[model samples]
Structures are given as C-alpha cells and as structure tokens.
Target chain A: MTSDVETRVVRIIAEQALLEPSDVKMTDTPVDLGIDSMGLVEAIFAIEEEFDISVPFNANDPQGSAFDISSVRSIVAAVKSLVADQTT
Target chain B: MRRVVITGAGTINPLGASVPATLDAMQEGRCGIGPLEIRDVDRLSVRIAGQVGGYDETAHFDRQQLSLYDRFTQFALLSAAEAVAQSGIAFNGALAERAGVVLGTSGGGLNTQDDNYRAVYEEGKNRVHPFIVPRLMNNAAASHISMTYNLQGPSFTVASACASSNHAMGQAAQMIRTGLADVMLTGGSEAMLCFGGVKAWEGLRVMSKEACRPFCATRTGMVQGEGAGVFVFEERDRALARGAEILAEVAGFAMTSDAGDIVTPSRHGAVRAIAGALRDAGLAPERVGYINAHGTGTTANDRTECAAVRDVFGGHAERLVISSTKSMHGHLIGGTGAVELLACLMALRDGIVAPTIGYREPDPDCALDIVPNVAREARIDVALSNAFAFGGLNAVLALARA
Candidate 1:
C-alpha cells in the first residue's frame, strides 16, 4: 500500500514537472526536477486528488510548509502519512 | 510644488492591444463589443462582452509564468511593459528603489476562482490548485508589476469597483506630487469575463444582452469588457530631464463618496467631484474642452452623469466635447478610467476627439455635446476623465496638454 502511494505520488510529481517518472529521482528536490512553485502546487493538488487526502502545503511559504516537498521521496512519505491518517 | 506628468501610456483593450492600435480604432469609431467567448456562454442571459480577442498567452508568457499569472495579472504586466518601454525610464539604483506600482482591479483573479469553483462544485473535485490564494488575491497584479519592474517604494492594489483605476492613478499622482516617490507605474486591469463572472452580473441585471449604447435613446444597459491600461507617472521635471515625450499632464484628481446609495449614483456627489477636480487643477470650467463622461448606458447612470456635468460646468457643458468611449471599448469596470484616459490624450495630442458610437436618437436627459457617431478635430487644452463606480464612489481625473 505504501509502495502504491509512492508510485502514484511520483507519477503526479513527474507529470507536473513535465518529465517521465523514470527521469525523476527519489532524492531530487522539486526544483531539481524543474518543478517550480506552481508546479509543486499542481503536484500536491494531484496527489490530494489521487488519494482523497489533504496535504498541508502553503504556496506563500513553500519551504516552511508542513508537507515535505524537498525531494520526491520526502513528498511520497508525506502523502503516505496523510493517506494513512485519512484512512485510519 | 512638484508636478506629475504621464510620460508613457500602454493598454491591451478590446479596441486593440496597444495604444497606437487603440487610438486608430478610436479614430475610426470602431466598436470592439462583440460575442461571448468564454465557457458556459449558453447559460448567461447577457452573452456579449468586449473580450481581448486573439491574445496568444503562450506567445507572451512561458509555461512557468502561465501557471503563476492569472489573466488580469498578465494584462497588467503586458501593458506595463509597453508603457515602460515607451517611457525609456530604466529603474536603476535609487530610482528603482523609489519607483512603485499601483494597479486597480475589481476582480483580480475571478477566472481562477471561477475555474476552481467549477472544479469543486460542478465537477465534484475534492482538491484545488494550491496557488489559488495568490492568484485570486486583489493585489496580485500590482505585486507582479512591482516585481517585474523592480519597484520597491510602495506597491498595492485598489478595489473600488469601476473607479479603481482612477483612484489608483490618483494615489500615485498624489505620491509623486507630494514628494513621496519619483516614478510610479499606475493603472488597472480586469479579466472577469468568465462564466461565473457573467452569471454573477446577470443577477444584477445591469448588463445588456445586445450592446452598449451610452446616451442613446434605445440604450438598455452596460456591456462588460476585459483588458488593462498601464501608465508611467513621473515627476514632470524628471521626465523633462530625461527628454521623455510627455503625453499629458496629470493636473488634478478628486474623489468623493455619496454615502447615499449602495448602487445608484448621487448627482450631488458626482457634481462635487467634477467641480473639485477643476478647483484642484486651478482651471475654470470654461478652460476644459473635453469630458469623458461616465456614460454607462444604464438609464440611471447616463441621466445622473449628464446632470452632474451640467451642474459642474453649467453652460460650458454644452460647448465642451463630451463623449463616452465606453460606447466603443465597453465598460472595463476597474480598468475603464485608465483606458478612457487614452481618449483624453487623443484629444490633447492629436486634436482628435473619439466619438460615442451606437447612438440612434438622443435622450433629453443626457443632452450634452456628445461628439456623437463621428470623431472630431478639436483644439483641446484640458480634459477630464470621470469614473463613477458602484457603491457611490466617484473619482474624476483632470488632464492638460503636455
């Protein structure tokens, strides 16, 4: 189930950055994947839509946002946690 | 006392995308009001709007920029670019620090809101785009223009409905005249032609289903328009020092509130503002040659505005060339006054006054010299742009030949 969340989040992030999932690295930050501020927002929106879970992301101060968008792997973990909380 | 002058003017309106193109359209008395182009057009009772047609957003902005800038902000930035380019004033060092941006918009990101609301309510989407807050904020255009031009002094947005642009420009002029800043980018933009926008206006019933015919006996209601007009207001001496071609002098601006009605305009309030503008500019009413009446084509607005002009200028109202370019470009709401200033410039610089088209028979209530149906050659020394918004807020700007 965690792996499913990771795959879906990675695909959403890749789609927002206009890249293939294969091109997106687990350790790569959203900026490294060419995901701008808006791109990150789109990716987060897509993830929330996919999982039916809320993401605590704020556009005004993205760095200080609770959702860890520093790297692809971190975003996946954050989504997994949100999904688990929602389901439980 | 310091003076403020308009060194550059730019607009992307329904008439045309630039000042030269818009002026040409005005000279020919061209009408830009046409069919509804946005989504859900079938649902709107008032289907027509003056849309900025054939604008290729991809040609103007990159994908990254497209994601961030809503339509209103895009209009603001594009018009500001043209004005700043024409002015040839590079914001550097202290100039960059002192220069600022003040833009007006009644609906900053109504399109964004409309889109998201549709997604959530109509489409049953659970999530919204994360940048919705920034995109929909009223000050987004002003903030973006300040960022693009590196203006650091004071930047903000004013939202007084239709009077927004005039009020914003008035504030910028006051700042420059009172030694608050040296150069200011001031104007307004509006892009509220979305489906939700039209639906909301439909509830008010102030919109026309067919056309905008201001001062015409057959007129019904106002037509909505979407676009922007940005101008560079620099201290007169600074513009002269740089040898910038001054377009017009921002002689005076006056604002008044009726404190009377939420929707209907007050003739006394409008008259006071018109007279106060002349008093502030130190020009007699007879010195004014042109008046851009806030002839919204609505029965109440046209009659009230004409009465106000008559009250202020008395006998001079009949002699002055009065016209409503809203008859051409449509009512731009917050952006109307700024774009109408172009008509003042046309009257002052080229000695050509834009006409009020779509007129069939004159109504006795609005019986002023409405340069009807055709452009005229007039040696105008002074011009006034009137903007009366909903909620009884009125702002009028007085301009003189440069």
Candidate 2:
C-alpha cells in the first residue's frame, strides 16, 4: 500500500531526477535514478517543504546522516517516521 | 617583464588589529573566534564568529567620514593608511597618477543594508539615510582609498566571492608587471557579520556552531569572520631604488574557474590553479615549502583541497607544511585570501609557519603535515596561498622570500 507520504516522497525524488513519478521505483536508489549530490539536496528540500518537517541531512556528510537516503523506500520510511514524530 | 613585490602589508582582523599583532597571534596558534556580539544574537542558530571586538567607529573616523564609511570601508582605509605609511610613497604628482587601488569585497556595506532594511521592514520606518547608496556600494572602499591617497589611475574593485582578494592582488601584480602601473595598493576587506548576513548564510547550512576544525575527522563546517587586509604591490626595481623594505616577491598568480558545480568545490580546478601558479613562478614543486590553504573547515572543502594538493605536489605534498588560519580567524569570505597571504609572508620572511587550530582527530583523506594545533619554525624559501570560492572560482598566488 502506497501511503500519502510515500507517494509524495516518490514524486519529489522523481522531480529531482527529471523523471515521471511512475518511472521511479521503490527499490531504486538515488544513484539508480541518476540523482547527484545536489539533486539529493534538492529532493530533501522539496520533501521538507511538502511535509513541513526539518530533515536532519547535512550536505557535507550525506552518508553519515541518520536520514536514510539509500533507497526510495528507505526515504519514504524516514519521512513517515519524522511526520509521526511531529504529530506525537 | 617587470617584477612585482609586496613592499608593505597591513591588516585588521579578529586575530589582531595590526600586522605585528596578527603575526604574534598566529605564532601562538591562538583562537580568535568567540560568541558573536551583535544585535539580536539570541535569534541566530550559529552564534559564534570571529568578529572584530572592541571596535568603536567614532574613535577611528570623524562624524562626517563615518556617514560615508561603512565598517568594511573603515577597515580598508585604516589598513591602507598603515600600508602607505610603511611604503613611504607619497602619492603627489607622478606617483599619484601612476598608482591606483584595487580592493576585493563580497558584501560591501552589508551592515548598512541590514540596518536600513530593519528600519523599513521591521520597524516600519519610511525614510532611509541619504548616504546609504554611497556607503553601501561595492566599490566604495576602493574609491575612498583612491581619494585619500590621490590615486588617479586604474582604480577598481573585484568581486569574485571567496576568491576576490587573490583575484584583485593578481590583477594588481599584472598591472605592475606589464608596465601599466608602478605602484598599486591592493588587498581585500569584508564585514558581513550582521543579522541579515548570518541569516542568509544559515539557509545554506554550511556554518559550524561550535568550532572550525579543518582536516579533522570531527569537523562540522565553516565559521564566518569579518576584517580587512591591505598591502602595497610595487615594481621590484622601483621599490629597491627607493630603499623601501620589500616583504616578499609576488612571484606568480593564476586563477581558474571550475565550470562545474555552483557550490561544491572541484579538485581539478584547484589542482590546475596550483600547478599554473608554480609554472608561472618558475618554481619546482619541491621548492615550495609552505601552502596557506583555502581550508574553510567544511568537510567538502578540506577533503577536496587536500586531494588537489596531493595531485599537484605528489610526494612533495607530504613534506610541505600547510595550515588554515581560518581555524583561528574564521573565514572572511572575500577578504580571506588577503589575510592568509600574511601567513605566507611570515613563512618566507619570519621563518614561522602558522598552525591550523582546533584540529583534534585527523582524517586519513587529508593526510599531510597540516601544522596542527601549534606554530612551527621552518625557514621556507617560497610559499603559495590558495583561495577557492563558492562559484567554482579558484586563485593561487606564489610568494618568494625577499
């Protein structure tokens, strides 16, 4: 089941990758989508704006960040968790 | 071709207010960064900076001059006065017409802009100060210096973000080398530690709140600083003939654009700039004993600068003593290179290499003798100063002992 958060995350990532939302896959990584470091930052910004949550991602050290950006599914899960934290 | 050399140098930075004082601070490996003392300090997330503390504008300038002089301009004028005094070159008839000023600054009168913006937007004030335009213009410092010194030829300002100082100095050297000018007053100044300035940089998320630790694995990011450094670049023959004290020879200068990312620094661009400077100076890689790195303490900048140094110097890279004074004084943005050049002068003339303070854990990626935490005494014949800006612009300068 694609939650609203998952759908929005996919759309944002797809926008940065310059592809249609349907073309993006849940199992695909940012590298698979040809998203560069700057592209990833843009996608993070878009997700933060859409969800109104501050993403703890530092562009200087993206890999060490707690925000899981390894795969689309992982990003969706991270966003969902952050949204839940905001609510609770 | 005529040779260019630095005859006089002066500076007012967070580390100190004069060349001797600044050199003393650098020799001690002292950290000048502290909690910023500005308006609305509670509102800023990144509250620490290398600000010029205990500065009173009224003490330096009269009421009439203060109306037209911004903080950056005041710094430039004060430093330029010291430099001109040291050079003993009275710009009267011929020298005045032949000499000029070239300064670099990214945010000219940013404080003035921030103040007026607050007055109109935040405080709901309508009328603004009349001299605001003259006070806030980018070329205001250069113009004021030119007017004060009666410099009537080839006066201008350079604005290339972080590489502004190096670019301006390089142009000044070329003017003297090409017989366009006999004397040129060149350096850089930046005073952007205002609320609006900090707020804007906060959006980029590259500032470190705690400390600036370049080449350290525990490093977070860069810290903002504010100050100015001014110098006298003159033709070698003229300076020798006049018996003026020559600090260091402006051996070579080269600038390159990355043409890649807008914000992320490129290793290739930095490498090429270093290599080009060496080629221009006719110095071998091994002869270069010290490098004043454009080490902003950011993870991306430090690693990339280290890689570039390795690529250019190869085995000699390990032998060369490199340090980032920004660790002590903070990054002055456009004016950083000008102040860092003083480190090169100290290395060549005083035989003392500045240290990169706040370095705790070393990063394997930046494996080199970074002169960490303590100043070292090393007699170096030649040194290089590097400046890499946000727009992928890179400038490297080579200086040799007089």
Candidate 3:
C-alpha cells in the first residue's frame, strides 16, 4: 500500500527523471532512474516544497548527508520521518 | 610576434590591501575568511565570506565620485592606480593612444543592483537613483580605468564567471603579443558579497559555512570572496626601452570549453587547457615547477582538477608543487585568477610557494604535493595559474621569472 508521502516522493522523482510514476520503483536509486546530480538536487527541492521541509543535503558529499538518497524507499522514509517531526 | 611581460601588479583582496601585504599573508598561510559584517546578516544561512575588511569608500573617494563608482569599480580603480604607479609609465601622447584597459567581473555592481531592487520591491519605493544604469553597467570599471589613465585604445570587460580574470588577461596579452597594443592594464574585480548575492549562491548548496579546506578529506565546499587584482601588461621591448621593472613574463595563455555539464567540471576540459597553455608557451611539462590550482574546496572541482593535473603532467606531477590559495584568501570567483596569479609571481620571482591552508587530512583522490599548511621556498623557473568556471569554461596562464 502506497502512503501519501511515498506517492508524492515517487511522483517528484519521476518528474525529475522524466519517467512515469508507475515506472519508478521503491528499490530504484537516482542513478538507476537516470537522474543526474542536478536532477537529484531539483528532485530534492521538489520534495522539500511538497512536504514543507528543508532537506539537509549537500551536493558535495551527498553520501555523507543525513537525508538518505540512496534509493526511493530511503528518501520516502526520510521524508515521512521529517513530516512526523514537523507535526510533533 | 612581440613578447609580453607583466610590468606591475597590484591587488586589494580579503588577504590584504596591497601586493606586499597580500604576499605576506600568503607566506604565513593566514585565513582571511571570517563572519560577514553586511546588513541583514542574521537572515543568511551561510555567514562567513572573504570580505575586504576596514574599507571605507568615503575615505578614498569624494561624494561625487562615489555616485558613479560602485564597489567593484572602486576596487578596480584603486588597484589600477597602484599598478600604474609601480610601472611608472605615464600615459600621455602616443602611449596613451596605444594603451587600454581590460577587466573581468562576473557581478558588475551587484551591490548596486541589490540595493535598488530592495528599494523598489521590499520598501515599495517608486523612483531609483538616476545614475543607476551607469553605476551598474558591466563595463563601468574598464571604462573608468581607461578614462583615468587617458587610454584611448581598445577597452572592455569580460564576464566569464570564475574564469573571467584569466580570459581578460589572456586577451590583454594577445593584444600586446600581436603588436596591436604596447601596454594594457588587465585583471579582474568582483564585489558580490551583498545579500542578494549570498542568497542566490546559498541555493546552489556548494558553500561551506565553516572554513574552505581544499584537497582535504574533510573538505566541505567553496566560500565566496570579493576583491580586485590589476596588472600592467606591456610589450617586452617597450618595457625594456623605458627601463621599467618587469615583474614576470607572460609566457602564454589558453582557453577551452568543456561543452559538457553546466555545473559539473570535466577533467578532460581542464586537461586540455593546461596542455594547451604549455604548448602555447613552448614549455615542457617537466620544466613547470609550480601551479596555482583552481581548487574551490568543493568535492567535484578538487577531484576533477587533480585528475586533470595527473593526466597532463604524469610522472612530473608528483614532483611539481601545487597549491590552492583559495583556502587562505577564499575563492574570488571572477576576480580569483587575477589574485591567484600573484601566487605564481611570488613563486617565480620571490621563490615562495604559497600553501593551501586548512588542509586537515589528505584526500587520496587529490594525491599531489599540495604544499599544505606552510609556505615553501623553491627557485621555480615557470609557474601556471588555473581557472575553471561554471558552464565548463576553463582558462590557464603560464608565467616565467623576469
């Protein structure tokens, strides 16, 4: 079952990757989805705008960032966690 | 073809206000980046920058001159005055007609634009200052320098982002080399430390809130800097005839485009520029002893630049000393290559190779002799200054001891 956060995250990533939301899978990474470094930054910005959250992602050291962008599932989970924190 | 030589050089940067002072700071590896003291500082996420401290425009210029001279123009004029004085070449008669000015600046009067924009939008003001157009124009600095020096020859400005200085100086050198001009005042200046400037760069996410640590394992990203560097490039024969002191010979210069990513740097593009410069100068790869790298402290730039150096120099890369003065003075963007060229002069003339300060741990990816933390004394015959800008533009300049 796709939650609201997961659905929105997939849509945003799909928009940046120029793919259909259905084509984006939970296990897919940004590179696997053909998203470049700039595309990833834009996708993160879209996610931030959609969820009203400031994503702490530095393009210089993306791997060392706290906001996981390894896979779609990780990003969705991180967004969900951030949303939860905003509520509390 | 005529030969070109740098007769005089002057600078006003975060590192120092004069050439001697700046060299002293580079020798000591002093970091000039500190908390920015601009208006609305509390609003900015990134607060540190290489801002020229203790500068008061009123002290240097009258109220009437301040109306026409933006911060960028002021910096350019001040540096040009110092350079002209050092060269001791009074521009009059035939020399005035043959000499000109060429300056580089990415953000021309950005502070002026920022102020007027705020006045109209944020404060709901209708009318702006009348001289806004003349004050904010990109060619204002070059025009002012030409007017001040009575240079009636070719004068213009170049805006190639970070590579602006190199491109401008390259054009100046070409003009002299081709015998089209006898003397050209060339360099770059940038004053983008305003609120709008910082806000725009903050969106790029390539700025470090702390220190700029280039070629280091713990490097964060580049920090913005603001300043100006000016030099008098004269034909060798003319300089010798006048008995003027030659700083360094402008051996060669080359520029190339990556035709690749808009943001990401290409190693091949940098490699070609470095090789092209050496070829233009008729310099062997082994003869080059020092390089002032375009080390912006960002992960992508440092790695790509290091790879490019390794690809170009191969075995000699290990022995040649390379350092990024950006770590000490911060990245001046358009104005950077001009200031960094001072490091090359120091190496070729003074035997002082400036250090890449704030280097904590070595990044294996950038495995070069970075001259980290401490300045080194080495008699170098040839030196290179590298400038790679966004949009894939790369420029390199080679200099020899005079």
Q: Enumerate the candidates' DockQ scores in order.
A: 0.01, 0.48, 0.75
In the range B1-402, model 1's lDDT, one tens digit per residue, is 799999999999999999999999999999999998988798666789899999999999998888889999999999999999999999988898889998889999999999999999999999997899998899999998888888999899999999999999999999999999999999999999999888877655467777888988778788999999999999999999989999999999899999997887899999999998999999999999999888888878999999999998888888998999998989999899889999999999999999999999989988888988899999999999999999999999999999
RMSD of each: 18.3, 1.8, 1.1
Candidate 1 vs candidate 3: which has greater TM-score?
3
DockQ of 3: 0.75
Chain B TM-score against the true chain B, candidate 1: 0.99
lDDT score, residue B20, model 3? 96
- lDDT of each residue in B211-287, candidate 3, tens digit only: 89999998989999999999999999999999999999999899999999899999999999999999999999998
Give the per-residue lDDT of model 2 (tens digit) for B302-374.
9999999999999999899999999999999988999999999999999999999999998998999999999
Candidate 1 iRMSD in angstroms: 17.8
TM-score of chain A of each: 0.92, 0.96, 0.98
Q: TM-scores, in order shown? A: 0.82, 0.95, 0.98
Better of 1 and 2 by TM-score: 2
Better of 2 and 3 by TM-score: 3
Q: Please give the distance, in angstroms, between residue B175's alpha carbon in candidate 3 and its true position after superposition.
A: 0.3
Ranking by TM-score: 3, 2, 1
Q: Tell me the tens digit of each residue's lDDT in model 2 across A11-59.
A: 9999999999999999999999999877887888889899999888766
